[model samples]
Target: MHIYVYFIYLIKNIFILQYILEDKEINVFHKKEGNMEMNKPNILHIFVDQQRFDTIGALNNPIIKTPNINRLVKTGVAFTNAYAPSPVCVAARCSMIHGQYPANTGCFENDLMPLDNRQTLMDVLTKGGYRTHGIGKCHFTPDALALKGFQTREVQEELGVESVENYPYMEYLQEKGYKHLCEPNGVRGEMYYIPQPSQLPPEDHPSQWIGDRTVDFIKENGDNNEPWYLFSSFIHPHPPFAPPNPWHKLYRPSQMPLPNIPDEFESLHTFVNKCQNRYKYRDNGFDKNLIRTMKAYYYACISFVDYQIGRILDELEKTGNKNNTMIIFTADHGEHLGDYRCVGKRSMHDSCARIPLIIKQPGKFDGGVICEEAASLVDLAPTILGAAELKMETHNMDGVDLYSLIKGDITRKYVFGQLNYNGMDFIDADADFENYVTNKECKRAAFSTYMAANSDWKYFYSAPDNREFLFNKKYDPKETRNVVSNPFYKEELKNIKSSLINHLKECGETFGIEGSDWKAHKLPPFTKDPDRGLLIQDGYTPWVDTYIPGYTDL
Candidate 1:
């Protein structure tokens, strides 16, 4: 009877052990499948306004001190050839968020905004259970209209006193007792290349403030179970050419190297010549000292921003979120920095269009890899969504996922950019309107510029005159000469033009020159309103037109 009792006890113990093991297995399955929400990676997107592709030391620039950015490059895949979809600030940023080219989004200029009804990257991420936050210059729309999808903490760089009030960065300046000196040299509209040190302390600079706020956000929410996406945008290394304190003195002007301006720059294109002339008259001259000083301040500003980036990265590491967070660093567009004797963007040159792009995803992708694939800022949205393992309707997006390119699943042959002079006022209306209306080349150069570039060749088409400029990029990387007139490259030019036309069709672009059989047709008419001028007239008045209702006959 005792032996029988021992056998029953042993059988009960086996059943209990089996029950416990099965229960643990069920719990493990729940954690893996049911709690997939907790497995999403955090995204930290760092954007610098008007930063060039060549500014980072890791990308072959030996002079600029971007140690923190170099650290990111060491742990990230740096795209050596990344172009901005639009060279202008608002258009480029709009392309970034919308995952479409400016042509598709109808945001071809600084003043234009993407349609509010259209879904953005932030909208997709927020819907996919990610907290979205924007810290600095979004420039998507005016300050009044908050971006539809994200909680924004803006730090705008407004010029006039009336406009400056209530701006986050301006308010910060007020608190720091430096509100009186907001604009460099007290100039408002165009003060980008002024070579004066900023009067405000380094701590109060916009770059530092942006970085500080980003760190705070990370620390407060890093441990939270929900995934987060933060856009840490900086406005520096862009304007006023003023770096504060030691940074201002960090790079001596005399030691800085000037951009190479070719002897044949005059014969390149009318637009290029116009830019040079505009700067020469506006800034007194593009003298050696002026160019060197601008370069010094620009480099110093980059280094300062790099320092702040280091602090933000340090915070991420301290919070133990480094391995789980994907860090992406890029810029809206690039600065001219005296390239072709120009000081700002709005050109089709590589200096104005190509930007730095770096992505760091620890334990998921190989570190210290350089991706030489041709990519654009428009690819950013799809890439972020892909990295988050989220799915959406990407049929409307013009760009492909960078991950696919990185994984060798896809390839990109050419990158495109658009320069629509929607809001630009290049001439006095009273003095220049007659010439603008009559001179085809002048009008075209002033109105629109379209670009298509691969690794070896680049093609630019000016809409107003239906003129084309082709460059052998491998030989003339600086774009000092227009080679369309050469017989040797005639076939290449024809092919590029055909490719651009096909791209326009793919993006559903109806504006500018409509083409067929490798030939251009009629040019799009210019309307009274510049923003709507590029749109083909179809007897429909734009809502922005300030005309009395039913007064069309007038």
Candidate 2:
């Protein structure tokens, strides 16, 4: 028996060695196929928070000057119709990290982090023999796990008090003798719609700090033989609308255009109207001047982020890793930026759902190719894994490989999105009638929302009121009109609804749909309570009553 067990162990070891050698050979083959200079490609994924698709200059926006991003677009494959699976921060990020939707991951809201044992993109890449590092705002709960599969991690927490010693950004500020400078404008936590110049110097700004740190990392590890995956996430262009120094004055408010509020905005869906009314009553509403000023600040923030990206790219080139690195630029979600009189996310509007996705695979694809393939952020993991010559089980991913879609090997008919208000707030089903309704006439309409969109049409379903909204993208790109009840487009509405139902079934989600027969999706078990650590360890504070437009109280 002992001799037989030894023989079996030897056989297993041989098979493991063969698998490793095969993986290396496959990587070499991918290099040759793509005409790459290295056997393994390094991935530099730069992600910005709350960035809009129209913000990039290459995407035809006349205002913002994103020359660096434009250069990537000029050389990369730009997906014109990319969207977020969930139009919120944590949920969308979870989808990207796990290659799964909110329902599958159980990360349905900003406060809900992924379960500890869940498989992440970093986990896969690290297991595939890549050195993974994460910089800036990872937003992972239990801060220690922020770098789960990352061999090294350096994070700059977004929101924190000076009293907290664990906040890296605050510590950096303290080191610079600029203690308590993050809130220099006297704006407490969750203060929104306040436009001002950053109190810190240009070099001391968080965006600049993130750029400097990332460049340092590249210079240190750029020439290493092992492949690496670095995620440089920036937290700017998300809130406070503050940019330091020259950036704050980069654009003049008077020269900017006003938000495109439709003439029939008041008669639009009740959910939208309610959001607008809430903002108006709560903050006394914003005027034209304030709106333009906010836009200027927002643009300045984007430009600053662009400058940092330029610096990072320059570092990559300096380190001789430019040709072997696959650069991906995208955002977690999009900001409303005064669209429909809204400033934050959490609605079904395109401004909040659509994100910019650009992938530059050296030598594999030509520059300046605009692929109009409908894609989602969830596809990012599989696409990156594919580029690295790694394979992921199809059953484990909700998004398809974007490279296949770009090469015309695979086609997607529609992309989907979801919003679970129940996950956002802790509300009693029987008490919160005003915000959540489950009546037969309007079951699943008030709090939960889902969306389905193809190349030409977009459909939204609100569960609280059983409301359905349909818009034709060819004519109504801004989604100003709801033609769901239009007799001429009855078939289109039905088709979209059917597509969404099929998707829900595939994802094993039964919520939002009005039926009790469907099976509930099996989500990963949370080993720890999501709200246990709060702001000290988690990047966010749950149930905080704040002045932000979209913030809710339990």
Candidate 3:
């Protein structure tokens, strides 16, 4: 067993050796070396909301500074073309946790229950004896379902039941004396604009509270013997378009770079109508200055979130748990930020669906590995399960294990994504539920959309109307030109359209192997043992872990 030399000096206790070798060698001295086999390295998933693909410094965004995330990218694999199968929060998060597509999970929209009471990634890992904890914005189910895998939850608590309903991060901070972040004022209606932290103390901001809580949790639980899976979901870089004073001043509005927006961008798709409707309600319009200020604050929030991320990594290093910990950083979905004059997700455009996905697997995968192959958020669940040596079935799972992709095996030709095209689901829900749906069902139903891509040519298929978009990504990465009706690529369009239909059939109905591409992997039987917390607790966290660093001091 070759053990390349590296060392760790604990503040008060002992000196430990770090090794560079195969899994077998590490397993040999696992016990005596203080790195037990049973202590299988923990997974730390840091998810940010509404962050785009180019937001990270490592991705060549010289204008937007994100050093902490850049460091993660440098030390791991960055899936450059990663996208959410569904851009909305609930659908995306549900797919992420279950490794199933939104259509399959039935949590296809927000504020919905887990499909068929199915076990989640947390449930599976917890059942397999791993410690689990969750902190921050959980928008999927109601507060009732939010605490399923988490022992403690920090949610959106500052707003009223009508405003705050399922917002988890806000609740966590409001409970911890950070109430000013959500104070309603005359500047904007309640819940529309979360005012910049003018009246609040520094420590009262949501970001700062989340960071503080996470640090405290690490200090307390870093010494635990069992392996753990901790997920911290940040609400920032998700708008009211307000950053705390510190973050607001961190980036200059004039200096913030603007994303590419074609003058004729709105003409490309019918989804822009939805953007038009959303703008009428919020005062933050599509004007250049407003967008610039919003972008600056957004970048500042990104920087602020990065600082909090650094804090978690710093705490992990200080606690001597850094070596055996795997850090996975990504976002729920990307925001349009005025791209195509749209503010947020709910479309299949790059600005809305594309997100940053970086995985830093300590000692296993090296830093600075960039994978250009397409990937989905749903891939994260199975990838994590695979990393921990836990058994995970890909049955009914639409996402492939990303471990292989990270290792440089690029075999995929095309990646697929879709939004629901049915208003029936929306018409069936209550006002609260309807709010969570966000008119997605109606919009998608009004426009059944599908996007298919090869390495260069990308196709966007709009059914019923039969509108098509064909763009050469290599030539026009901005995706400006739509050559769908161009007589030159008729055969190519036919092939892509046929492929999309077949893919939809496979994804839609669980057809068998020759016809049913889905693998029938079974979820283990659910038991009603009261001690189920043993498994569920693998993802446990303290209340304060929801705060972000550099966002608080007052």
- The lDDT, on a scale of 0 to 1, for candidate 2 is 0.73
Expressed as tens digits, the lDDT of each residue in 20-88 for candidate 2 is 545522333223234434466889999999888889998999889899999999998899889888888
lDDT (0-100) at residue 293 of candidate 3?
A: 74
Clash totals for all candidate models: 1, 6, 38
What ranking emerges by lDDT with the best candidate at the front? 2, 1, 3
TM-score of each: 0.81, 0.82, 0.77
For candidate 3, write residues 180-290 as lDDT tens digits: 332421122322323253344346555666787788778877877777788887777666556666667877767766656776775665433243223334323556665
**Candidate 2 ranges with C-alpha deviation above 4 Å:** 1-38, 142-145, 161-166, 182-190, 269-283, 393-395, 422-446, 515-554
What candidate 3 gets wrong by more than 4 Å, as runs, is 1-35, 142-145, 157-159, 162-199, 272-286, 393-395, 408-410, 421-447, 463-466, 509-554
Decide which is better by lDDT, 1 or 2. 2
For model 1, the stretches where C-alpha displacement exceeds 4 angstroms are 1-37, 143-145, 158-166, 184-190, 269-284, 393-395, 422-446, 464-466, 517-554
Model 1 has an lDDT value of: 0.73
